[model samples]
Target: MSARNAMAAMLDELMGPKRNVELGKDTKVTFDDPDICKYYIVGFCPHDMFVNTKADLGACPRVHDDNLRLEYPKSDKFEKLGFEREFLKFLSRLDEDNQRRIRKNLEKLKANEENGQKKEDLRKLRDEQEIARIDGEIKLCMAEAEKAGEEGLVTKCQELVDKIEQLEKQKTAVEERLNNTATIPPPIDESAIKVMEVCEVCGSMLIKNDAQCRVEEHLSGKMHMGFSKIKVTIEELRFDNGSRGHLLMLLDISVNVKDGDHVNETDHVIEIGEGGLDRVHEIAIVAEVVRATDIVGMIVIGVTGTETIATDDIVAK
Candidate 1:
């Protein structure tokens, strides 16, 4: 962690919940207190998740207490207090900022890929030209050695031979490098290519066809966790609503409609008799209608928040 972040964390400890309760002073703190961190009470705090990252939000300004967080759900207000909304709104803003950053990075990467390949081609062409020039020099030296040998200047001929040998070695090295540079790597699978995408949850730019472990690590990272927590909390609030009490059941319904005698839009009135009640065996909820009930008498109910519904089979608890 950076020095600044470390100090911020230290201050959070000294001045937050630790100061309020652990210091032995009588502190009458409640979950509803403005000083208490509501984000922590609802779930994970976004301020704590992004520390030392480019998205670092610094330390949470409010006090974080495990006791207070536990007490929050049991409070009279709970979801009515708007703590979840506040937390959701803040995280959403953070993600929005991150999405902009991700878009910029994508633009840069696209431009760089083209430019980088052009640079690589230029370098290869230069290396090839150097090898050709060196080969020409070697040929000239060989000609000189031939001329000197005819004149019986043995010493000069030998020096020319040595120079030609050195040039040949240089040419060989360049050719080897050129061959290696020209080599094509094995093709990657198309299925693997599709896996890489901008993470909608955390607004991160993931590597294209990254290693499995690295992808797993990214999925489990703090930023991902921070964003994923939003969905979990929303689901909790949804299920916590109706009388069925968050029940999940395996349902198989085949209904024959008789007549739509009366119209009750609040809950569909299913005339499927006693068998429907036995299958669900749970409290009731709300749903929509499919006109008259003759061949379509099934008033199948889907659970939704803050609405109470009744049917012949399922009763509101």
Candidate 2:
């Protein structure tokens, strides 16, 4: 929607209950009414995604009429509603914001990982020092036992030997504790509470490689669902815009297949349009040349040039 249109819609939607009555008395309802949410008309509204959650995009200030939404796709004004462009712009901003959040979250996780390792190292160091102290005490006791034995004090020497044995057992206990810290199991990053990471799309906390069930549960959650819907809708809107409201199976332009590079056979063609087959359009979304063969229902033609496709290779049902 245009800026002027959006402003007018916001004003009208925010009108007081009394003003709404007055407008109804003086105006008529139309699908193109400024108060209707264009995003909703296009498909799903982003505002509905995070209700009751931290990412909640509070209530939308515009009207969301189901009737209008249903009628929009079939409306004569469907082509270039401008709302689709606006929707794409809005989604792009959200995507950028989410990306920033992911970066920030990763920094936190990195810090947490460092702190966790430091804590473990410190613990192991303390344990090793305690064992060294015990060893030093045992060495002194052993020397005393040797001197006592040489002086013909058998009882004192036996006592020193028993004391050294107790110290050795105590040292063994500390060594076991140290070994536990150096084990292979993944330790909890107490700084982060427990291996927490950010969800790239929703910016919410997720356990790194969490249990499959928990992962599924998170994906199905309202916040994730909301962001996922926005992403899919944005893709559809871009596709519609590029194909001019027609669902055209265009080549994935990003592949960048060079000329005569052995165009590989496809399992299935990649489609990117949303229109019915009734529309009189017939261009295969493929590379600049050498289109898909055996198009059973439509004429397949090269989009970039009039490259010769075999007459017998294409048939229309």
Candidate 3:
């Protein structure tokens, strides 16, 4: 059985049937030992593998039982409205101050939506008034055309009629949109938190909070800060243009490398220089070029290695 299932089985055997409990509240459970994972109390335990491996007792059984009973917050109802789990997790990770800020932002979003609806109603009213005015103009033009018996007056009356029809069609479309907006719930703005940044090291998009909890969590994450000692080297080499002058070079070498042919093949090896240096560094094919026109006869490459490649170093393949 998998470690997760095994743990579940163990919990069932120890705690009877799984029952709900209110989270963030003290539970009545008796334990002989005091060494327990605090994260397990809230139901997020990252060291489950260690427990299955018998490296340690994992999380205290009582804590796990208590977590299973912990009640989810009422705001979690947003999940039913199609709010993503990540968004829910983001909200939970926020401190009390940030949570209040998020609530305020949600109110603002609703207010903005209401204001927009008012503007749309006003615009629709104006369109209706314009349509009424156009109808009067068309009637006047038609009477003038009949009195004068002129082709020019008749054409002017026809143009006025067409303009009124167009206005009516536009007003109908606006009315439909407004009705739909009133009936359907608006989508929650993911960017309502306001403070957001992309991690430079891993390119992970992170949202910030007033308490800086999210930012600190992201920066301290193992995936984000794990490669601190790793370095990449890229060598740029320029070849003579032959007869096309310096502007038209035969080859433009960059540190970045991409191989379209072996994109799906994970076992392929990339060799650098004529010497066939095997264990160079990490090579990632960030993008695939299906058309030759995209590269313009020049290869694009990005390299990550032990040492930073300098412009003076000549890298040949």
Tell me the whole-model lDDT of each prediction, alpha carbons only. 0.61, 0.63, 0.39
Per-residue accuracy of model 3 over 84-127 as CA lDDT, tens digit each: 22222322332233335446565666676677678768966765
**Deviation of model 3 at 188, angstroms:** 19
Q: TM-score rank, highest first?
A: 2, 1, 3
- TM-score of candidate 3 against the unseen true structure: 0.24
Off by over 4 Å in 2: 1-19, 23-25, 30-34, 153-155, 182-200, 208-211, 241-317
lDDT of 2: 0.63
TM-score of each: 0.51, 0.63, 0.24
Task: For model 2, state the Cα shift of residue 243 in Å.
Answer: 5.3
At residue 222, candidate 2 shows an lDDT of 91
Clashing pairs for model 2 are: 247-273, 247-274, 248-273, 249-285, 250-285, 251-285
- Tens-digit per-residue lDDT, 48-124, candidate 2: 77779876777676787676678777887774455765666777777677777779888988897899799879988
Output the lDDT of residue 9, model 3: 57
Per-residue lDDT tens digits for candidate 1, residues 29-109, read 767777678888878777887777667888777767787788777876656565765665665567567668778777766
The reply for model 3, stretches above 4 Å from the true place, is 1-94, 150-317
Ranked candidates, highest lDDT first: 2, 1, 3
Model 1: pairs clashing at backbone N, Cα or C within 3 Å? 257-294, 258-294
Candidate achieving higher TM-score, 1 or 3: 1
Best by lDDT: 2
Model 3: residue 295 alpha-carbon error in angstroms: 78
Query: By summed lDDT, which 10 consecutive residues of candidate 3 come out lowest?
Result: 229-238
